[model samples]
Target: MMSSIKRLLIGRPLQSAELGEQKLNKTKALAILSSDALSSVAYGPEQILLVLITVGAAAFWYSIPIAAGVLILLTALILSYRQIIFAYPHGGGAYVVSKENLGVNSGLIAGGSLLVDYILTVAVSVSAGTDAITSAFPALHPYNVFIAIIFVVFLTILNLRGVTESASVLAYPVYLFVAALFLLIAVGLYKIATGQVPPVLHSPVGTPVAGISLFILLRAFASGSSALTGVEAISNAIPNFKHPAPNNAAKTLIAMGSLLAVLFSGIVYLAYYYSIIPNAEVTVVSQIAESVFGRNFMYFFIQGTTALILILAANTGYSAFPLLAVNLAKDKFIPRMFTIRGDRLGYSNGIIILGIASILLIIAFEGQTEHLIPLYAVGVFIPFTLSQTGMIVKWVREKPAGWIPKLMINATGAIISFIVTIMFFLTKFPQIWPVLIFLPIIIYMFHTIRKHYDAVGEQLRLTTCEPSFQIEGNVIIVPVAGMTHVVENSLKYAKSLSPNQILAVYVAFDREEEKRFKEKWKQWQPDVRLVTLHSHYRSIIQPLTKFVDTVEHKAREANYQVTVVIPQFIPKKGWHNILHNQSSLLIKTFLLYKRNVVITTVPYHLKK
Candidate 1:
């Protein structure tokens, strides 16, 4: 019944050979892996202005330079990851690259960092998506966390159905978001160029800021770097692409990066030109849309699509986390459960874990994107730095064709990424320390898991062909309680296991009951010898346990092993369990310490 339910929920079990069927073409791959990067433009520019506005209206203009800096870094990441795709095409993300080129410890740290970042991605995306809705309609703000949790749960179920199905369902929204943003940008640009730009005062109060400082501008750059969080996803999941996987993956990476660059640049320019301020009641994007389209159908259309793409951005994490987990599992750094795919050819365990973690974060933070935004971007850069650094080492050591330029590109990327990581850590120290603390703990866990697997393999390894411990034959013992149908069933099962050797034992607290049971058994001619042990006290378990110990001793002496079969009645309703005496449980508990004695239970279900 459980298997039936699983099959119904996630479809039938897929054969290993069917993996190719799950491979995605370029278009679907972009939708599945690029959603996170593409969706960031919805809020990335606003993150910049939010920090810049802190220094009063005078600092708002600096958003352009900060965005330009971020754009430069983004371009560097794209080029570096393009090299990553070509060199290590077998889905070599940070963990794989670090482990291969750097040391095992570096790989574990990268894995842990990426895992945390994926969790944050889901949390921030869902919260921001929920906030988008509540910003447009304030009446729903109170249930923000609840709405966010619903979105996570829905995505969880959709992803469990399989990767292809999820990509197909979610791909349309990303395109719609892209079209809406492009239209908004074109209109905004045409208006600006034609001297028809609208005024920017949505509220009576002008944009507020504190005094301008270099530290403030750097902080704004670090904040806006949230856009770079999902850039490595394509390089991480190159294996998901169809034929010519590496080439297709690199092309998709370029496509995603190009789209992100254009959309982000256009949005930042419009926001700056319009002098748009981040509104508490609505989003900067929403304000830009309204100014360009004036609360028309297109305004609401852009708003709806923005919310959808933000929510679907989480699908990128779902796609990458499972693959990363499988990589870690294959290396024996984590449990083997993550290596097993579900009926839908998806990593079910990894997907569920991501969902639960993200949901808890949403609950803890009350679905406020600002509170989560500070905690974001820090985990992302940890892997970004490590992956690029590992690639530099790879190029230097392997000396492949054009290794010099490759080394130079990756070296530049690594240094830039490391600087960005430090900037994020220093700027958001209060919110960032938890991730630092979490990294060492995760590394420690990986070492412990490897130790356990090593120890288990040593014990299970076979040196000689001879049996570890020889056993001549089997001795089956059935514990009977009177001549009830359950006892008869257990005796039958014991006979099936050991046809020629079966012993029935009865433990009785009442002499009168024992006498009557023996007489009745003799007349029944059951062809089984019965040994009745008398218990002076009213305890029914002690004598039965001692009998099993004696049987095991006798079997050892005779070069045999003992098997005890006990009968149990399973009640139809769970509440009916309280009505039983639980003698079988007591007998099983005492027999747990018997080394060579095998205990089995035959359950007879009660109809009523």
Candidate 2:
């Protein structure tokens, strides 16, 4: 019943042969891959003003120049990652680039940063989308946290259906958002051109206190760097694209980067021209829409589309995290479970994990985009710097045809990124200190897991020992609760093993019940020996394990293998499974790690 519900919701399991069909075209790929960075126009500019607002209303003018600086860095990263796509077509982005060019430790730093950033991308994007909804309908503000979590769950289910299917569903909302913003920008620019400026929320610019300074400028730039957060996602998931993934991805990168620059610049300029104030209750984009469209259908349309696109932006993270995890797992740095794909060919483990982590962040931060904004870009910068540096190393070592120009571009990005990373840590230290502290710890964990996997491989390698050909007879043990068909089935399965000896053991809690069982066994006894174990503590598995240990100790002396056969009862109804004690399950669970004991089960299905 549960599986039926799952199949209904997420669709049927997809075949491996259909994976080629799952590959995305450039249009669908742009929607799913670039949504996070594109949607940053919703809040990126406001993050700049959020820092500048404390000074005074007059200080908002600095936002334009600071935004331009962010764009410069964004341009460098775009060009750097275009090269990254062609260089590492297999994906892994910064992690693979740094590991091969720099060192494994540097690769861990890049991978760890990317991992944390993907999780934060989901949290920050969903929370901002919730803020958009609350701005449109003020009454929903109280439930924004809950709504954000539901958004994460919805995206998880959508992605779990398969990548191609989700891209088709999500592509429209992204185009809608871009269209809304383009309309907003065109209208606002026309209004300004005709000398019909929009009204302000408050009149008369206030006095400047603690006015423009280098510190505030740097802080605002760091905060607004959220605009560049998900640009690396496309490079990280190159395989999601069609054949010639690198060329296709690089083109998509240019398209996404161009849209981001125009939308971000136009929105920030309009926000400044209209004197929109940054606030938690209402977003900058919402305010811009209200001022430009007079709170009409177009205004609500903008808000609705903004919310939808922002929520869908998390698709970038869903696309990248599993691919990154697969890279780490193959290198033996993380758990192998992350390497496993779901029924739909999506990385189910990574998707589920990213969902849960995003939900926790929403709850912890109370779904406020402002608080999550500080922790957002702090993660991505490390990867950005390392990826560029790795690219520089690649160019220096390989010296391709146009190596000098490529090296200069990556060098510029690496230098800019390294400085901004330091600034982010310093400017947002109070809010982001926890994340900075946890990074080294995550890197340490990566090293430890890699070492453990290496140790296991070394110990398990067959090259250390010579080949042995030996055959021996088997001794089988069957534990019976009574003289029922279940016991008969268990014994029948045990005898099929063709054992040297068979022992049917029973753990009795009551003397009277034991006598009756023994009498029945004796009457029906036509083949094997029956032994009884008395349990004074009334424990079934404990007394049974003791008897098996003694039998195993003697069996090894005779060069015989011991096999334990147990019987399980399966009910017709799913809920009826809880009605039995499940003794066979308990025995198997306890004896699972024993090197000398082999355990097997014979299950009998009950009609009622």
Candidate 3:
């Protein structure tokens, strides 16, 4: 039933040979990878105003300049990542570049930050999209968290379906959203140019710098910096693109960046001219749409599409996080499980982990976009600075042709990104202190995971030395709960192994039950010897494992190996298996690490 449900949700399992066919073209790649970045235009401008509005009315105008600063930073990142794509086409993005140039520790830091950034992107983007929905309908205000989580689950399942399938499913909506915004931009710009729109004043007694300080402006910029968060995704997931993967990824990055710049600038510019204030009740994009198109179909259209694109923006995280995780896993920084793809050739573990983490974050922050924004900025900029710096290091170390020009671009990006990050920390220090602690914890976890993998590799390393131990015939132990056909079949299977001896052991809590089992065994004239152990506390696993240890030690005294053969009832209905104790599973799990022990199962099929 579970497999049926999984099949229903994600479709049939894809063959491994179909992996190449699953790669997306540049157009679909843009929609998938740029969704997060493109979607940010919906809230990036609004986040800035939310911060600046705290200062005063006129400080709202400061948003224009701050947004321009964000745009400049955006341009730097696009160029820097293009360089990264050019260098590492196979794609590891920040982690690969940082690791190769700045060393393993820096690489781990970059990987950790990107992982955190992707999680926050999904949380923040979905919440912001939910805000758009609530703003338009006003009926969904109470269930925003639930709605956001549902979106995450939906996206996760789509990704698990396959990369190409998700792109095909989500691409149209993303393109529609982009076109809708471009229409909004065109109309809003015309209205402003024709003097039809006037600046809506938030305060009548507004004065510049009256209640605002430099810190306030910087804080606003930090909030808006989320606009640049998803830009690195393309480079990270270059392998997801079609033929000429790096070149295709670079083109998609360009396309996404262009859309982001135009939409973000236009929204901020419109908001500045119209004096849009971001409120819990209404998003800034909703405000702009109402101001430009009023409560007409166009307004609803913009709001609906904005909400959708924002939610879909999380696809960016869904796209790259798994790919980035594969890179970290390859280096043993994360679990090897992440390195394995699903039946659909997607990194199922990483995708599922991202979804679960994003959902938790949504619940933790109560689906408030503003609450997650301050935290989002930190993760976004850390990787930005590191990746750019990594590129600079690459230029200086390699000295490729035209390296100086490339170095200058990366250096400027590194400086800009670093300054913005530091400013974010200083301005939002009170709110983002938790992130400072969280980041180091992630990095430490990375190191701990790497050390464990390293240790496992060390243990598994082959040596030229002789074998450590000798093995002879098996000492088979058959565990029985009662005299059933299943136990008899298991005993026979054990006898067929040509073992030196076979012992059928039973742990009895009641004396009457033990006597009945022994009588039954004597009547049957079973070939195997019977051993009964009384457990006063009625503990099964502990006593059973202890007995197995004793038997194995005694067997080791001679040149013998221990084998435990257990009978399993195969229920017709899959869910019926859960009704039983499933002691065989626990037994196998416990005895798996024993060096000289072999465990096997004999199945007894149920008719019903």
lDDT of each: 0.85, 0.89, 0.86
- Mark the regions of model 2 whose C-alpha exceeds 4 Å error after superposition: 198-210, 466-471
TM-score, prediction 2 = 0.95
Candidate with the greatest lDDT versus the true structure: 2
Off by over 4 Å in 3: 199-208, 464-467, 593-595
Which clashing pairs does model 3 show? Answer: 35-313
- TM-score of every prediction relative to native: 0.88, 0.95, 0.95
Clashing pairs in 2: none
The model with the greater lDDT, 1 or 2, is 2
Q: Rank the candidates by TM-score, best first.
A: 2, 3, 1
- What lDDT score is found at residue 184 in candidate 3? 90
- lDDT per residue (tens digit) for residues 432-534 in model 3: 7887798789889999998998877777778644467787678999888887899888988888886449988899999998899899887784666889888
Give per-residue CA lDDT, model 1, range 422-504, as digits (tens): 87787889877888788999999999999999888877788635466578899988888767878888888888878778888
